[model samples]
Structure formats: C-alpha cells, structure tokens
Target: MFECFLEIAFEAEVLTEEHPELQELARQLVHEDPATRPAAIQELRDMIYERGECAPRRMDDAFLLRFLRARRFVVPRAHKQLVRYCRFLEQYPELYRDVDLWGLARVGCAYEGCMLDRPGVGRVTILRFGTWNPDDYPVEELVKVGMAMMEIGLRSPKMQVLGGTVIVDMAGITMKHVATLTPTIAYQIVCLMGLAIPCVMHSCHIVNYNWLLNTFFFLFKRFIPKKAWKMIHFHGHDLESLHQLVDPECLPPRYGGTCRHHATIGTWFNKIRKYRDESFDRDMKEFGWVIKE
Candidate 1:
C-alpha cells in the first residue's frame, strides 16, 4: 500500500522488519524511538494536511519515514523537507523529461558501483563524472541520471539510516565538460542535494582531480554551505588519501583498490530492476520514463 508518486522503493530483501540490526541502527542514527514514532508521524501527517501544499501522492508511514529519519524525527523539519521535495519535482519538469535507464545508459557515461555491504561503510556511490561527454549527454541529462540513481538508493532503509558516501572520479574532465555546468545548473544541483533530497550525505570523495576540475568545483563551492563544504575531501590522483576515508577493499582496481565487483551501467540497471516494484513505471511516467518493450 505504498503510494509513492516518487517511484522509489526499499530493497526487497531488507524491506521487512525481520532485521533487528538495522532497526537498532535506525534508533541510534535517526532517533527512531518506538514509543514516540507513532506520534511524530501523526504530527507530520497533520501538518501536511493543514498546509496542503506540495504534499506527496500518499502520506503512508513508509513514505513519511524517509523524511522523518532524514530530519532526525523532527516533525516540522520533516514536513518542510517533504514540501521542498515535492516542489522540486514540480518545478523541474524539463530536467526529468524522457529520463530512462536504457536511454541514459546508452550515453555510455553514467558509471556507478553497487551499494557496498561492508560492516563499517554506508551505501557508497561511485560517480565517474569526468568520463561524461557533454556532446553526448548534456548537463541536464547528467542531473537526471544522478537524481534517478539517488532516488533508487533512497528505497533502502539502510541507506536512510546509515546515509551515503560519494566518490566523484574526475579523471577525464575537460574545459568543455566544466563549461557545460552553468551557474544556474550548479545552483540547482546544490539546492537539490542540500535541501530537496532527504538522504544524509556522510562524505564525498573526489579523486583524480586537476586544476580544471578545481575550477569546476569552485562553481559549486560558493553555493554549498559551510557545514556541507567540510564533507568534501579532494584527492588529486591520490587513491591512498581516499582509502583513508573509504575502505580500499570496497573500491575497484581503477581507483587503486582490489575489489572487482563494481557495477557497470548495464549490470547495475538490471540488478536494481529485479527489486523494482511493478508500479514504478506507472508512477514515473510523469517524469517521462516510459519503458519501451
């Protein structure tokens, strides 16, 4: 009975409450108190109904939990975040138009690894942003693809409680790629990550960067908050530095690691597709993702 217009779902295996370990993590990280959880959710629901502005398609516990956990069970902050999320989707119709996995994968630049299961690590997302060619896929499409991946990751309760770690591979970036990220685009992306999205960003590791990439990051740095700025760690081709923060055993060989289970666009697409709900397509149609048969 999860009626999410956002079209995101928790992973199938971990969807149930059978895993007490994750439930404990939720209590520790997100302050999910068993006694007060019901009251908080009801307060959020009442706030949403009172405002009636940009409310989600459904206000079920499952959907509201994402926001609640993100805001550390603060009813008012969660409600505000929910509104911001809904408004972001409504405002950016053009960016999400025709955003499909098959079409985006065909661009040959959306490289992402799997959600790592190492005990100490959260969900690690490896985004090879430098490999993207602006000619093939514009910045708007890049945002669309990144947003899609994040939306998929949000379905995991583990991802919500444990939060996320991002590695931005800046190996093949050029002025052409940097120039494509206009100030407007940078501002919008910053806002999406900072406000609209409910996911907790634990850390962001940037590898293989150069002066060109530094210039590129400067565009986004001004838009980023002081607290969020501290989360970004820059490593210009120094994999060892990245290893100190992110476990080297979890990374792939190209990033100076020993793991080979990294996900290509096609493999990751198929893997998540297996766990995707039947209603995903119907719910995502508004974002212009029509599955071609």
Candidate 2:
C-alpha cells in the first residue's frame, strides 16, 4: 500500500513538471466521475491522514518496517550528481553549510528561464536569505544550469522573457502560511505569466512536502482564478519526498473537502538505501562535494 502511494507521488511530480495542466484535469476528472476518481482520491486522503497522525520520525524508518525487507539502490546519474555536490560542500564548507541542496536545484530551474535570452520569457527572481552565503553550494553550477534552462525557454516563440532578482528574509513566517505566501511573494518580486506570476521559494528546510504541496495546491486551486498561473512553493525537500507529495490525491482530492486515501506506510524505506548512498555519491562526483572517507 505504501509502495503504491510512493508510485502515485512520483507520478504526480513528473506530471506537475511535464504536464501541470493535468493537475486541473485530474481534479476535474474526480468531479466528473466521483465513483472512479474519488475512489483513487480517497486512497490518497487516507494515507496523509494516517501520516499526520502517526508522524513517522523519518520516511525511511516507516518504509523499512512496512514494505519489502530490503531497500532499493540509486540511479547512476543521481549517484554521480550527489557525489559532485558533496565534494563542492566539503571544499567550501563555510559557504555551503546552510546552503540548501534542493533549493539550489530549484534555483537552477528558474535560471533556465532567464538564459533563454528570449523576449518576455518571464522573470527569474531570487528571494534572498539575509544570512545566506552563496559559497555554500556550487553557485557556479547553479548559474550554469539556470542559464541552460533559460536558453531553452528563449527558443520558444510563445514564451517571452522578463528577468530580475529579489532577496527577502524568510525567518518570521509560520509553516502553515508558507504555501499561501509563496506565490504571493513571487508575484510581488517578479512579473509572472501575466495572470499570476510563477515563482519558486528557495528555503533551507521544510517539514513535509506532501503537507506543504497539499496546502499550496488547495489554496492555489481555490482562491486563485483559472487564468492565474503559479507553481506550488518549492523547498528543496528530499527528491523522493517531492516525488511522493506531487500526487493529485495528496491534496484534498476535491477542492472544498478532505482526502480519503490510505497512507502508504514504509514505502519510502524501500528506496532509502539507494537514495542515500547514491545521493551522497552523486553529490560528491557531479556537484563536487567532498566524500568523507
């Protein structure tokens, strides 16, 4: 059951990036045929409810106890990236200590938009953490990836470019309000899709991607108009968590309602060994983080 949830979560993340509109479609599908879609939706809702109530200390522990006896391994590319990133951190610990790996990756995505070097391709804004040091992560690598993505966006005639950077302190915000403020803050910082600007929040730590994404999606789908375009807040939580949380069912399954899916316990643990070791290796090799031998 947990494994199923993880699969659903992963699918959601992939769909969010590849076909965001599918989220809306999925919701509509549920509404269009409650008998089928709602069943799936209920499954997701049940899972989160249990998760919140149980509050497993770590996703890995939950996975190990509930799923397969052993855990899975990491993909080669992810391994390489993890090793490289770690090496960079070790080489420049002072700068990278507080730098969020996930945040850097997300910033890399935004940078992609800027590099497109096209007209009206949208803006790239960085919300500054007053105390953060750029040296922590591979800022150069981030700049490189951001530029590459931007170049891709520029090639598209339909997408224009408007770019800038914004730095703001995020110390006072409550966890509950994080989702609501994310897009609102982005809109304040940059000129997004003309309806509601698209923005990503680069934060150091987050409680749970499922909870956060669920909250953001609910608010986004409900209050924001149909024409408005805004991405849910992005904190570089574990990639696996992001994958798990992206499911349409993870949200309230229906707009003004609660979820009904059963929590997939121990599913994440099945892949922890692979994710951790591979992530470490990828950080060291690809991002140049130092490996502690």
Q: Cα lDDT of all candidates, in order?
A: 0.71, 0.29
Model 2: per-residue Cα lDDT over 154-215, one tens digit each:
22212211222221223333353343345433332222212212111221113223434454
Clashing pairs in 1: 9-155, 10-155
Clashes of each: 2, 68
Model 1, range 1-293, lDDT digits (tens) per residue?
Answer: 22231123224422423266887878888889878888999999999988887758667887788899889898898988899888877778665666555565654545666444453456666777677767775788777666666665565677778776778887888888888888878877765564688877777888877888768888888888787878889888887888898887778778777665556655555645655565565545644665544
Range of the 10 consecutive residues with the lowest summed lDDT in candidate 1: 1-10
- lDDT, candidate 2, equals 0.29
lDDT of 2 at 48: 39
Return the TM-score for candidate 2, rounded to 2 decimals: 0.20
